[model samples]
Each structure stands twice: as C-alpha cells, then as structure tokens.
Target chain A: MIAENYSLTGKQILHFETFGFLVRRNVFSAEEVAKINGEFDRRRASILAEIDPEEKRTFTQWPTRNPENPFTASLLDDPRIYVPSEQLVGEDSIPIQSHCNSYGKSSGWHVDTFDRRLCVIKNILYLQPTTADRGALRVIPGSHRSPLSEDLRNMDLYGFHDDTSPFLNASGMRGEDIPCYIFESEPGDVITFNELTWHAAFGGYKDRRSLSYNFFTNPKADDEIESMKKIVEHTPANTQGLGTVGLEYHPNWLENADNNPRRARWINWLEKWGFTDVLNN
Target chain B: MSMLTEQQITFFNTFGFIILRKVFSDEELAIMDDEFETSLKTIQGERPDNEVPKHFNWSNLGPETPFLSLLPEDPRICETAEQLFGEHVIAVSSNSNRRVGNTHWHTDQSHPHSYGLKFAAYLQPLNSDNGAFRVIPGSHKQPFNDKLKHIEMHSSEITVPYYSCDSAPGDIVIFNFATWHSSFGGSTNRRMCTIDFYKNPETPEEVEGTYDQVIVDEKVYAKLRAYGSGFHPHWLANPQNSPRRQRWIDWLRKYGFVKSEEA
Candidate 1:
C-alpha cells in the first residue's frame, strides 16, 4: 500500500520536465508488490493454459481494470499512481493503455510513437529486481524533445519497420551497448517516461515481469483530439484470447468504471473519443 | 588531411561526443604512456604509500616533455581539432592526469556561447564499472545543456543515466566542452591525458568572452599558474619552428597569455 502522506516533490516534477523521465522508489510496499506479482502470475497461467502450448519469448496482456483482477484495477484510483500522473500530465489525464508483460528477450531501442500531439506518459512497474545487465529499461534523457526526436526517428536504429536489418544506425555498437540511462529498479519502484523517449531493454531472463500503465492528457485542442482519434483507430486489439480480447477495453472494466468517479470520467472520455467502436465492430 | 569524416563530425555534433577507435597505433600509445608516466613522476614525484585517492595533474604540452609538447602540432590531433572547431581554432592547454574514482558529472565549459572541445586519451582499458568516461548524449546543445545543470549540482551520486564511453589504449574520445560528462567506479591512478581547443573568436563579444574566460575560469587559471611562466621557455622558443606552432605562439602572445619578450 502507498504511504498515507506520500506525494511527489516539486524537485521531482522539475526533474521529469527536464529529463523526460522520473523514477520513484518504494511507491508500493512489499506486500502490495507481492499481490501484484501473484495477480500477474495468475493471469499469465490462464493465458498459457489456453493457447500457445509452447511458450513465447514475450507475452503481453492488459490486466488493469478487469473484473477478474479487481485489486489491479483499483490501482487507477490509488493516489500513488494517479497523483503523480496528474502532476505530470494534468489532473484530467485519462488512462489510454495498460499492459502486463512477461518478457524473455532483449528489446531494441525505439520510441512508442512519433505523434507529438498525443502527449502520453507511461508508468512501469517491474515485478522483480532489475539491473543494467538484467533487463532494466534504458532511456536517452531529453530525446523526447524535437530535432533529437526527429533525428532518432530518421535513424531507425532498431529497424522497427524493417526486421531484415537491425541496429543499422547504432554507431557500430549493439543495442545494449548504446549509451543510455539504465533504469535499474526494484519491485516497488515506478519508472515513468514520455512515450516519445527512446528506450530499450537488454540481458533479461526468459520471464521478466513488467506492468505498464499509459496515461494521456485529455484532449482540448483540435489537433490533440485528432491525434487521439488516430491512436484509437491504429491501436490493434488484443486477439490472443488473454485480456480484453477484440476490444480496446475489457467489458468488465467498463462495468467497474461506473462506481469510481475518476474511472468514470476517464471512461467517458474514451467513449466520447470512439474508443468503444473497436468493440462494436 | 582531415582525420574525421563528415559522418563522424555529425556524430560529434549530435551526440556531444564521439570515440575514434585506434586513432593512435600501439607504438604511438607506448610512447605517450611512457611520457605521461615520466612526466608525472618528474613533476609530482612518486606516490606515497596509502596516499588518499585524488586526481593528480600537471601541464602536458610543455618543454618538460619534448615529445608531448609537440602533440598539438600532430596532424591526427591538429586536423581533428580543425575539423571540429575550424582551421583557426586555438589550442587552449593540455594536461596529463592520474585520476581517482568517480569524477562527478559536469561540463568543462558551461557558458551557453562557449565553443570548445576536449580530446581525451585514456592509456588504459576501461569500462562502465571501471572509470570509463560517461556522457548524456546531445547535452551540449541549449535547453538540454541547461537542463543538465542539476546533475552538476548533485554530482556525488550517479543520479542521472548516461552512456559510458568504454575505451582502450589507442582510442580517443573527443567531446564538446559543454557536454555533461563524468567517470564512476574507477580505481586510483587511472592514467589519462587531454587537449583542449576553442573555436577562434570572431566577434568582439567572443574576444572579450575569451579574455574573461582566461581570467575567470578556474581550470585555465590553475593551469597557467602551474606552468610557472604561463608557458615553458622551450615551448615558447618554437624548437620545431613549425609555422603552425608559430601561429599559436603569436596568438598566445597577442592575447597576453605569454610575455612577448619571453621567447
């Protein structure tokens, strides 16, 4: 559980603004992290049993806001998560995406999106101890800003579009060897970054557990709304029969939203933006 | 001939640093290493037992070491500096150091308009966990450069993330003077040397800034004082008598960094 008086400091807010990322340690207690780990394992086991008898190197499914994982869903209401999210992205920011990942292989460097108008931040929780050589997230500080962001976009260092060639522009080094800040973390720590920041992971075990929560600043501008529409349209539905299959949000998540004022507001925003259309079709 | 390619220059401009692998051959490195050791011993004397780990340095491009004094005129070093800072760049100073563990994060030059570069040659193998140079890429530019000032203030711990420039004996790491950089987890007596160069001042403001820098910058002032007369007599005498060295000497004398009558 979060401490009663816990809140992000002004210095931390400035750090996030300056560096494009922030790390808060022990945001969740040991007991809370243990509960999260247990919930993650249960979800993973269910997915594995039904499909993919041979385990894949990575498995990602949305575990938040689901009726089966009410404890995890309530994280949206928890001040430890929402308070900082509000501070960074404004109080009206809404949840855009959630993922619980079981990663086995190294991830190459890439930003989540190049759409500047989207304005999203991701808060990630590792369910295990992570170090530089053990699957920690690495980020290029201030790479989220323009020109550098545009430059990295042009480099296509990770070969996101062309799987045939990778690390083409990595200055003769492997992805892991690229100079970056490795977010070495413990289970209770939360690492947050702008979605446009360049990030990667390397040297991880076969079952490195991570939970990610993405929040987007509520659209007020025309361009922002348009960007939101594009995001909603382009986001592929999770069809792996794991969590929220063939839908942008799970049905139980919407059902649970009615009771929570903050969740309801977020759900209302999603509905207004046509996020529910993916389920309708 | 220019030692740096267009792509390498671009990398330096974009990332605030670049490592040129094997810039010096093994034989060349052996000579440099020998000179560095001899000069350190000659100037600072033998290290005492249980000496407190600290960064030790003395003037490098001076008459005390004839071979090292001429390094500024070496085509590989000179041409690279020219490529980065233009043909008229000023050779600021050079130093050989026995560095201790964890030099904290900072820019050698913090002024927004400051245009200078440092070429560091570490004579020993180093990695992230062993005193390798680390930098936050692109931090030499505005906004990013200013944003990194916090690291300078809170430098005791490696709070911010950085890219480690793990290097070998013959490698050279060239970086912008404003780039935020540090080394961590190093042992005492990590052998290294550096040459600093600045872009030639064109405008009146730049000239005044350069003069002010010479007077106000602690490192530059310290270096000048350490050289006794601001330059070695042999170095001032232009022993090799190269026109390039003559030009630098003339610039130094004109700027009042050296006495005109000393030579």
Candidate 2:
C-alpha cells in the first residue's frame, strides 16, 4: 500500500530534500531480503560480544538482530533507492543507520544529527506488514518547513525541552511544527520522512513483525559503516538511539536536551526539500 | 572548472542556486589574487577611507580594463562560462571588498547594467562565524509579491538556502542573473571578489516571464519589478561622484547603449 503513491521529481530528486527522508520504489528481493534477515542474527552476535555481560539481557531489543534486513545491504545494491538519495544529498549520502527493527521498538521522534546540516533522507524498507492500530510510523509532515521554535510546545509534535533539559532543548529545531503523516503500512512497503519530522513509535499489532532501518546518501562513496562507527564513538554515548547518532542526547533521561546548532540545521534542511509531505499524499 | 555539473545546471534553474567547491586551483588563485591586489592600489586614492584596509570594489579599480585579463588563461573557467553563457561572453564588473561588511538582500540590475559578467561569480569560504553570501535561489525567477518584510540573518519566509559557494580562497562560485543574493561582513572579516556574468541580451529572450512588464518573460519581469528597487539600490543624483556606484548614464552614452530617455 505504501508503494502505490510515492514518486520523486527530477528537480525534487536533485535538490528537494525533505528532512533527509527519501523513498525508493523497491529496495530488495525475496532472496536478498532473506539474506538481510540472516545478517540480523550475525549482527546480534556482534552486539552480544560488544555488550557487557550484565547488560547483555538489555540488548535483546537491539535493531541488529534481523540479518535479512532490507534497511541495510539490500538497498545499497538496489539503485532505485540509492540513486535519488545520492543525487539529493551530496554524493556523500551513505548508510549510517543500517539495521532492522519493528514499530514498537524504533525509539524517539526527534531529528537526526549525523551531518547536522544534512537533511536526513532515510530509505526505510518495511519487511513486515504494518498498520496504524499496530503503531506504525508517526511523523509531523509539513513541519519540515516550519520556522524554528521558540518554545517546546511551539516546537511542533516532537515536544519541547527548554534550554534546561539535559538532552534536548525545545528551542532548537527550525521550521514549521505542523503534525501529519503517521504512516501505517502493509508488508513490502517502504517509507521515508523528513529529518525534522516529529514521530514516535508505540505498541503495534502483536503480529506486526517486520524489518526496518535508515541509510543516508553517501556521495563521496565514503565508508558509511566507518562513519557510523565514528559517529557512535565521538558523540556522547548516553543519547537516545537517534540522538546517539547525534540529534538530541538521551532526552528520556537528561533534563536539558542538546540544543546544538547543528541539530537545528538538519531540521531546516528536511523542510527545504519537502520530506515533510506524506509520499502517498 | 565551474563545479556545477550538467544536472546541477538544471537544478539551479529550479532551485535558484547550487553550492560547490574548488573552482579555481591554488596556482591560479595566487596569480589572480596578486593581480586583484595590485589593481587595488591603483584605486587606493579613489576610495576615501585609507583605514578601510580590506575594502576593495570593482568599479573603483582600474587599468580602464575588463578584469578577465587578470584571470589565468585557463580552459576550465572558459569551459564553465561556456556551459552557462555560451561561446564568447564579456567580463562584467569585478568588486573586491576589503572589510567585513554585508550587503542587504538585493539584485544586480539595481546598478547600471554590469559589464563582462551577467551571472555573479563569487569565491569565499564561510561557516556561521564568518559571513557567507546568502541567496534566495528561485526568487529571481518569481518575485515575492508579498509585502517586503525585514528578515533576520536567516529567514525561510523571504529567503531560502542558495547554492552558496562556502569555500576557502581560490574557490570560484557562480550564480545566474535571476538569482537573489546578499553578502555578509559581520563579526567575522569577509574578503571576497564578486564579478557578474550575464547572458548577452543579444543572445535571445532567456525565458518568458511566469507575468510582468517589459521585454523579459512577464512572470520573471513582474518578479524582477516586484523587488522594484529592492533588487537594485537607488543611485544618487550625482552619478559621476558616487564611489560606490558606476557612472551608468555616462557609461551608457560612451558605449552608445542608450539612444535617449523620455525626458
């Protein structure tokens, strides 16, 4: 159902970047998809190795457990997703957040901070069926173009955290704060939204089991894996998963959110390119 | 070469601008900088402020010549200009500002038409701390008919992210005539050389206006006139004396660009 309406224009593909969210008509094959699911187990093993014995139990929710993930290697081989993203984002757009997870698991609705100035064009492949009642993806569509917020409630759907918050500041993100596009999907569906999109995930159908994750445009063809590893190490590790990749620090725990200017820049870029609009709409 | 590729050319047509890097090489830049610096001395007395050290401007500098001669005879620049303007194009005014100052958002037609460059070719490196030329990319194609509102350093309402050439020295950036842009010289010092590159009026109607007055496409013309003088600043009564301005009427008369005005 998600694949029926999304299409990209030449100019839009070339320059119209929405909060770094981009859609690829098709990103994987049944076989390739299966392989990705296979990689999930491999990655889980790695995560297990990395996790401390005491925290290993907590790592069960980690996104890497799905090896047959379309969100990772499958899209790289599929040019449909990679080409447009490559064109819109500089040649440097690459897979930074490559893993698979379900709606109930995807954490946080804040903006991404990899290239703080980069409007995140995420290509997410839905390996499983999705439905709104099951808590599919939620987004603040059109909020990409909204002006930077002066207050958190005024900051659109992502909620506000004034300067005092340890992890995020409400006054940070720039552009419209409109709320729209909480995606409910069907299997084989792919979705992309702006970087500034205000979204959160919740309990979906107990049966909703799918693979999903984000990758960016890497024009330089630089090692996307290397960059993510570095980003993970360099940034304050205590941030929420998305914030850990750089937008806001662990907003769940910290009082003051990281209102870094770079974060705002990413938000602005999302709106400029039109990712805030629901692709089907 | 103009860093803008073919796809970029099309994107600029729609978005208004594109930012790229390293148009000029280090070797070529040294020569160009020295030539630009040397020309600055010739106009030294022409500028009133001796202390305004980094402030250099195009119309003031002279050898009574087009600044193009100063650029190293390189094929890359020529190739770039050819892609944008086509075969033989003239060199427009070359303005080099010495101080860290900003120009309000405006257009080029405000001044008497420029010489060699129709599109402005800019070069500089900018981060938030330093000033970078800001532009409203497609605003050139369509005017903001909405009320003219004062904007902060960055405003999405009236302006948008342009293809800014935020680069270090030796990098050459180019944008077309229809593009809207502004300069910055805030707390940071901005040393930049801006030269306009225009498509020859003799070539043809660039495109029909989107509605508007005059010969250009009505849509674009309306947008152009919408900015009214916003795009072009007003010239004082004493045209020959204003150091900041070019002697347009006089220059037009010399070049026979003007037949006569409706007095």
Candidate 3:
C-alpha cells in the first residue's frame, strides 16, 4: 500500500524516467472510487443527454468542478495525483485540461504534441475495469525519451489529412499490432505518463468511462512561454475559440479551494495567460 | 569462404531480418546438436523442474564446448559481420535458450548508436504452426518503427501480417536488436540459441552506448555473469588467432569485460 503522503519510490521514479509512464494500482479507496464514478456519470448524463445510449459517442474536456461533484474537483489537488505531477513537471505546475470520455471506437496512435522546452504529463483515472481487448490505454515504454521518441514525432503514418496511408495497409497491420504496454486498469487505479509518449486505444465499449487531467510545467523560458500560449489558446475554450472547457475552475469548486496555495498558483498562472475572463467567480 | 550474398544483405536491410539457408553443414549441425544436448544436461542437473522453465539461456557456450566456441570465428559468420558492420565487428555474446509460449513483438533495446544484432539457430525443424519466428519488414527504420509499437500492442485484436521464418536446423537467422520479432505457437520444449555481435564503436556516443550495454546495464551483466567470460582459457592458451579476432578480444579486455587467470 502507498503511504499516506504517497511520494513516489526511487524505483517508481526510475521506471517513469526510463519508460515515460507508470501505474499506481488502487490509488483511491473503494468509497472514493464509487463517488468518482458517480460524479462522472452525473455530469456525463447532463452533457450527453441528447445522444442515444446505443449510439457510439465521445465528448472530451468535460468540466469536473461542479459544486455537486466535489470529488472530481478535489482530484486535481489529491496527494495521490498532485505529488507525482510535482515530481515530474515542477512544483509550480498547473493542471491544464480535465476531460472525461464516455465511449469511442479504436482511436488512432499518436502523441499529444510535445514541447522540447517543457515537460507535460497526463494522469488517467479509469472509472471501470478495462482490459487490452476493451480499449485499454497502450503505451510504448521509453518512446517519449530519446532516439525513437523523436522519430515518432516526425512519422507520416497517418498522413497530413489523417487519411489511411500505405505504410499501415501495405503490411495489413492494425492499430493493435504496434508494440506497447497494454495498461489494463480498474477503477481507482491511476496511470500517469509523459505527454509525448506514443499511445492509443482499441476496441472500446460504449460505457467505458475514464477521466484525464493534463499538466504542464509553469512557463519560464521564452520558448516554453510561447508553447504554453499555444497550448492554452488551442486547447481550452476559454482563451481559444475551438476546444474544450470554458472555465478552468467552477465558482463553487474554487470556493472550496480558495485558501489552498496550489489553487492560488493555478489561478495566477491562468490569469498570466490572459484567461482572466474564464474564472468562475 | 561462405559470405552473405548481395541479395541476402539487401533482404536483411529491407526486412530487418533474414534467414540464410543451410549456413551450417550437416557435420557442424551434428557437433552443435551434441554440444547443445550436453549443455542441456548440465543445466538440468543444476536446476531440475518437471515443467520446463519459462525461458532460460545458457551463456558463453564457447568456453564449455570446443566447436561451439569457434562459431563466431566461422568464415560464414565472420565475413557476414565484416560486410554488414565493418572490419572492427565484435562478437559479444553466445547463448542457448529453452523457450515457452509466445514472445510478444518487441525490439530488444533502443540503442543510442549503431545496431546490435543476434544470429539465431534453431535446433529443430519448425514452421509457423509450431513456434516459427516472425518479423515486420522495415519496422526497424526510424519513423517506420515508431508506429510498430502501437500495432504490436494490439496484435491479438488486429490481424497484422508478419513475415514468418519457417526453417530447418542448419539455417541461420540474423536480425537487428531494434527489429520487432516474436515466436508464436512455440512448444514447451522449443530450443534455440544465439550469438550476438555489434559493430565497433567509433564515436563518443557509440563508445558510451557500448559501455552502457556491457558494463552499465544490469540485464547485460546478468548475461555476462552467465556467459561473458573473456575468451575461453583454451582459446587464450592455444590461440588459432586471426588479427580480427585478436583485435576484438583485446577491445573486450580493454573494456574490463574479460578476466585473466591472474585476476
């Protein structure tokens, strides 16, 4: 069992530093897991209400900071998640995106665009048991670090238009044939990985639920600041025209975390990025 | 005298691996078989289990077996290594394996420098139905290989066509360590062995990679502890030495991999 403070062990850090990903089994208590699932479903029903349950659908970047769903918002500051993020990126890091996916078919293999100047990571919390056959998160170990990782960034497999390319079809290789770690997860298990890591999902069910929080280092360098600008403007709907989430935090959710210094830092970071109008206030 | 043909080398470069037909003669095969059987006896005597161990390697067979030890020096092997790598190629490791079940598709290691390769010889005649080797062509190349990781992860769910190497006992299959390869439909008693070699490091990065591979990595050390002694004492004493072999051995000793009788 992880300690109460839940600092990463040296071996865990080594694995992450080498492999670009790590899994913490049973990071949440059973009750917390249930509450998290309840919060996700509660919010999911409100947003995807018009869509038929039978029809396949995917909606990303859902706001988890609803006052009624405090569990989801508190997850951002949870020691189990925050400690590792601090260790990976920097202590001054801020959570950038929170997204929940309901169901989707096989997603293509890709990385979430990496910046050479910054370290970005994604923390995934599955709401249900998932296996390799059922759209489990698959990652290539050490694919984010060096030689091969750069190759992945420049590959033209999917092509400019995301059209099917000859590289994939010529050999009859599918999304699953790629060598990677099949992260079969149960609810409450947390899988944290570098944003640059190559990953994909295949054969997902309709009700398969999971939440993701993307975090990046606080911008210091000029290139890093520019990269951060592009990230905030292009990703979240607040600063950017096309993307997910209008506000980084909900007013009710911010009320609960008003005194917390981490939350203050997060808000300050957002404001510095010209996202002042996005505050829930 | 028996070196890889131009076509064979092209095939290897294009497909990331190749199978040379009957690289070893029948007499050599018999000697290899004997040496292998004797090694199996020694290993079993050490660790007896009813069910075969999932996977275990017997390293440094050259020290234990007379003929097997000389395999790296064989004209066919030496010439091929020279052509592919350079005059400074070094044979680093030799080992036999008792394999079980499926080895999922994976590159051996992501090397920072030049490629390291494994020359494999299967003891039994095998086809795709019974533990034959398989590989994806061009998957070892930079951008092309990057996409293979995702495909390999989902191989069970997706039908990714791969080259199945159906072979007999005398054939030699050589492949880059970065190439994605796996054995499927293997029996509980599947037997195979490999002699690993690498091009001499010329650059600082390559030198560091060489050091990391032999001295720094724990996994590499495990294999070394089992099979990585300096050249066999007999070979050292009665050197049927070639300039090439001696240079390579000298390099290994220089790197502190080889232990002398004095030490």
Candidate 4:
C-alpha cells in the first residue's frame, strides 16, 4: 500500500530541497472542497465577530477544540494527499494540525529546518481550488537553495505589510514576483515544497481556501514505528470533531529515549512551523 | 552593560528570551546598507510575477531597511553570528525595510515557531526620532494569538500623517526571536540594519548548520498545519503595526507594562 501510491520521487525530493516546494495533482474532490469551504464560512462568521479589528493583534489563532462532525470530517477527508504524505514524510504519517487550521486558515512562511543545513518539507492539499481570483497560494521557487539571508526568507513571517505605495513598491521579495503561485487543481491538488522555500498567500476571493498539513520523520529513528505509534495515543480519540488547534502538542515528549538524529530533526521542524512556544509549553 | 551575557542565556532558558546590545561594528553597517540598496530594488513592484511582497526597501531612511543575510558575502556578519550562535547556527530568516518614519514598532515573532531567537544589529546610528529599540523584557511567555486580537482594532493601513514614531540609527537592538518590538519612521533620515536567528535550545548555538539534521517535532508540524500556511496573515509592510505599548494603549487595558489576566 505504501509503495503503490505514496513514495517520494528523486525529482520531487530534489525540488523540495532546492526550491522548497513540490506539486501533487488532484488530491481532493470538488464536493469535499465545497463541503469544507461551507463549514469554514459558518465558523468564520462567529470567529470574526469576536474580534474588534481596531483593537486586537492576536486572536486565538486556531479554534480551541472540536470533533469530527460534518465540517471536520470534510476538513480532514483529503484522500489523495494523505497517501502521498507517506512518500514525503514516512509510511505512517498523519495530519499534525488537522483540526486547528480550519479555524486559523493561512499558514505564514518560515525557513524549513530552521537553517540551510536542516532538511524539511511543507505539504499543501487544495481541498478546494485556490485560484488567483480567489486567493491562490504564492511561493518563491528554489528559495531553499538561494544565496540570501535568513531574515529575507522570514520577511513575511512577522506579517505581510500592505504598505506598497501606488507610486512606490514594497521591497524584499527577491525571486520572481510570481514566486508565490496558485496551486492549480479541482479539489485535491496536493503540492509539497521545501520547508524553507519562500511562499505566500495567493490573492483571491471567498471559497478560495485550501487545507495544509505538515509531517516529519526521523531520517534515522531507531524506532520510527514506535514513535509514530505514540503519536496516535497523544491524539484525541476519534478526532472527528476538533476545530483547528494550534500548539497541538509540545516538544520534550520525544527527548532522551529518542536521541538526536531522527528525534532532533523532528524538534527542528517544530521551530520552523511557527510553534515558537513548543519548547516552553 | 544590559547585553546578552551568561545571565541573559539563563533568562532565555527560563523565559525563552535574551537581548544583545550594539554587538555590530560600523563596517558591517555599511555592508548591510549597500545590500539593502541592491536587495530592495530586486523585489520592487516591477517584479509582477512574484506574489509574496513580504519585504521592503530604503537605506537612506528607515530602520532595518535592508533584510538580514546569513549567507552575506561579508564574512564579518557570518563570523559574528557563528561566534554567538556557535557552529550549529543557521539563518532562519532575514529582512530589509524602512521602519516607522518616526516611530515604527512590532516584535520579532510575528509568526509563531517551535524554538528560535531574533538577533539583530543596527547598521547605522538611528535618530531617536526615527526609531530606537526597546523590548517588553520577558513577554515571550505570553501567548499572543496570531490573530493579534489583543491589539487595537487598527488595520494594517495607518501611517505617518495620523501618528508619529522614531528611532536611533547606529544603536543596535537584538531581541528574542519571540520578543515584541516596534519602531517609528523618523521624519529625519535614518538607516538601520538587522538579522534574526533561530537555533534549537537543546543544540549548541555554536554547532555549524543544524537545520535539516533535526526534524521539527510533529507539534511544530501540526501548529503550522492548523495556523494555515505561511501566507494567511499577509503581514509584509505597514506602519500600523507599531510594537507593544501602543498595542496595550490601543487595546485599552488596565496595565500596559504588566501582563494581563488573559495573558
């Protein structure tokens, strides 16, 4: 089953390490995409009302907790991508923040592996067709291998400053303007990129949404199978009804018994994914 | 010398933060300035194809106008980073932009991360009017939502005419990768240079290139997955994003200096 549908191709792996991105076509069905989008709107309405835009900077980023109801089921049911995940991360990979992103939407960019020496991958499943007219995703091709500064890669991490003047342009995007490109698909266009690859939000209107999930593997885990087994236990049983939850789990859980090679790589990925508080938590 | 000494390392350990004063030299500043001049022009609106306009330009006037470079041709900057971070250090991200003309403000951790630090240096002496570096000490422990719900309901559009903020040029400011800060674009010309770094707390800062060797925990993976992709917040350029105190005042909380109940 693992070899049949999910395995990283040499070309894809190269793309991931060099540019920081890769693509998978038709990873989701149209109906599923529409279903998730509908639920997103329903929850977003209430979430948006809670915030007074003029006076707040941080919202509870991801929804606190939820179950696998119709909305969540739709959110998590991306058949095409999960199978592909086995190839990129490992044979037994599962969505890390499946419930939380539904509430937050829009993952910002940061260098994968935290630096060039580290290796990591980012996965994007267009549970829905994200078009430029509807906010297609944008990314800097080959950014992972660029001769640029780390700050340059993370420029958008703090936030995208819409301070571009009609007369003057905002600076700092080094590659092509379209480095950030739309993930073209019907519903399940699962694209994977280098974790360090520079990408951004593609511009579009409502329903231009997508589902993103990242996974990691210890390149040399003594017991990769055992560690993955523990992950399932940590997850809430019947994860059928949880909203997107950020800081899903903390680090340190895999220390000592796991050693650094594989275990250390897992922790490194955490820092790049924007879970800055992981260690502290 | 309120610099990032051994005690600062302990503070970073307990609270997850550290501060380093003007650790950069004048020559580094000049190189950063020259790079900013070139880099800014590279990502301008002229590049219609590029979608992520997450960086800015302006060496003549602005704080940290030039993005930080880990692979900068200038060996001094890299060597300094190596000295501080140890051989295992990696360039997480860098930026070059003009801060508030008089008072721009915001922290390093706009985006959440697993474990990292924001280390920066002022390339030019900043005019206090333009923007000086100041931090909220140990605010990293607080869980500020990515939504910025606690900040005032100001959009990312406010600028010069409506408000004022400033800073000093040569004075270096290095806060935690998670610390919150802001700067005002001074009316007078100002130039600032800085770079942010990320290292595994468990790994020695001096370890050479430790990025891919370690796998980011699934917790980190899941967080990014849930927060959406690196593109949702779209926080690139804008003066409205002044740092913390203004956020406190705008939020109208009981104490701007003290942590709140929600925090």
Clashes of each: 0, 101, 14, 181
Q: What is the interface RMSD of candidate 4, in Å?
A: 20.2
Q: Better model by DockQ, 1 or 3?
A: 1
Q: Candidate 1's residue-wise lDDT over B1-263, tens digit each? A: 56876656766777889998998888888888889877765654444553433665666766667666777778889889999889998776777778777888888874545578988999999999999999988888877887776543463323576788999998999999889888989987798878888788888877876776666554645643323444677777777678987888788777766655666
Write the residue-wise lDDT of candidate 1 on A82-196 in tens digits: 8888888988998776767787677777888788986789999999999988989989888889666766665556543223224444345566655678898899999999998
DockQ of each: 0.42, 0.01, 0.08, 0.01
lDDT of 2 at A268: 43
Q: Which candidate number has the best TM-score?
A: 1
* Chain A TM per prediction: 0.89, 0.52, 0.87, 0.56
> Per-model C-alpha lDDT, please?
0.76, 0.41, 0.70, 0.41
Q: Best by DockQ, which number?
A: 1
Instruction: Provide all candidates' interface root-mean-square deviations.
Output: 3.3, 16.4, 10.5, 20.2
Model 3: per-residue lDDT, tens digit, B1-263?
Answer: 53865545654665567777788889988988888888878766665463346776766435567777778777778778777777778887667777778887888755647568889999999887888888755567665566555442553323343557789999988888878778888998888778878878899988777777765434644643333443555655436657766776687777655655513
**Which of the two candidates, 3 or 4, achieves a greater DockQ against the reference?**
3
**Candidate 4, residue A180: lDDT:** 33
Highest-lDDT candidate? 1
The regions of model 2 sitting more than 4 angstroms off are A1-281, B1-4, B46-56, B59-75, B85-90, B109-124, B143-164, B185-189, B202-263
Report the Cα lDDT for candidate 2. 0.41
Report the TM-score of candidate 2, chain A only: 0.52
